[model samples]
Target: MSSSITTILTKKSYPPIGHYSQAFRANGHIWVSGQIAADADGNLLKRSMSEQAHQICKNTSKILQAAGSSLEKTVKVTVFATDFSKLPEFNSVYNTYFPQKPPRSAAEVSRLPLDVEVMMEVVALVDPGDEAKL
Candidate 1:
């Protein structure tokens, strides 16, 4: 398989805050960056952990869609949180989005961009011929 890389972008999702693409496609996989609880307009949401988790999931879904993939195709996910105590809260909201229970890892971080409560990154399979949709 070719190792050529293609950066993924979409107006439906928030633009990268720094020097990173929202996602990248290569070797039949889509690697999504850690998505914060921000809207398409780049407004950060500082609500409860559950709310932030929901927004993070939404942002991830949008990026995956633009990459010609979906949450259902996700193979792995990594979640970063400011507080590990709120993991249950995060999981409650996360389960609604990833019912298939893909492989996941969660870690407590000292901080996140925008001081958001949660951020999530995912690696998902991109079906053969799916790149044509982008």
Candidate 2:
């Protein structure tokens, strides 16, 4: 199977620290990388679990836009949290982004990069005629 792939880049979100694009546009969808509570300068937000969740959503939103998509278009999401006890806080913030309540999964993990408490990745449908943004 052959598919055209476009790397998505944007200054609105934190720069990727690893050898991976922030997102990719292909086959009429956008695949965003796991987003954390990092700022544009790569500094961790150092905020509460809910606050960090807000930052991740904001970052993911920016990445989706850069890839010709939006949070409302998301079809699936996966969340990783180091502290399961904070799930409520994360869910509270997450609900605001996906008011449509897209299918999602959350799991407790041992740890995450940069020692951040939470991380999220998403898959969303690309808006028509917006591939140029990729």
Off by over 4 Å in 1: none
Full-model lDDT, candidate 1:
0.91
Cα displacement (angstroms), candidate 2, residue 43, comes to 1.1
Candidate 2 per-residue C-alpha lDDT over 38-132 given as tens digits, one digit per residue, 9 for 90 to 100: 98778899889889988999999998877778999999999998989999988998898889999989899998998889999999997555664
Worst 10 residues of 1 by lDDT: 125-134
**Considering every candidate listed, which one attains the maximal TM-score?**
1
Distance from true location, Cα of 109 in model 2, Å: 0.7
> Against the hidden reference, what TM-scores do the models get?
0.95, 0.93
Name the best candidate (by lDDT): 1
| Candidate 2 lDDT score at position 95 | 90
**Candidate 2 accuracy as TM-score:** 0.93
Tens-place lDDT per residue, model 1, 1-134, is 44889999998889999999999999889999999988999998888888888898999999999888999999999999888999999999999999999999989989988888788999998887776555
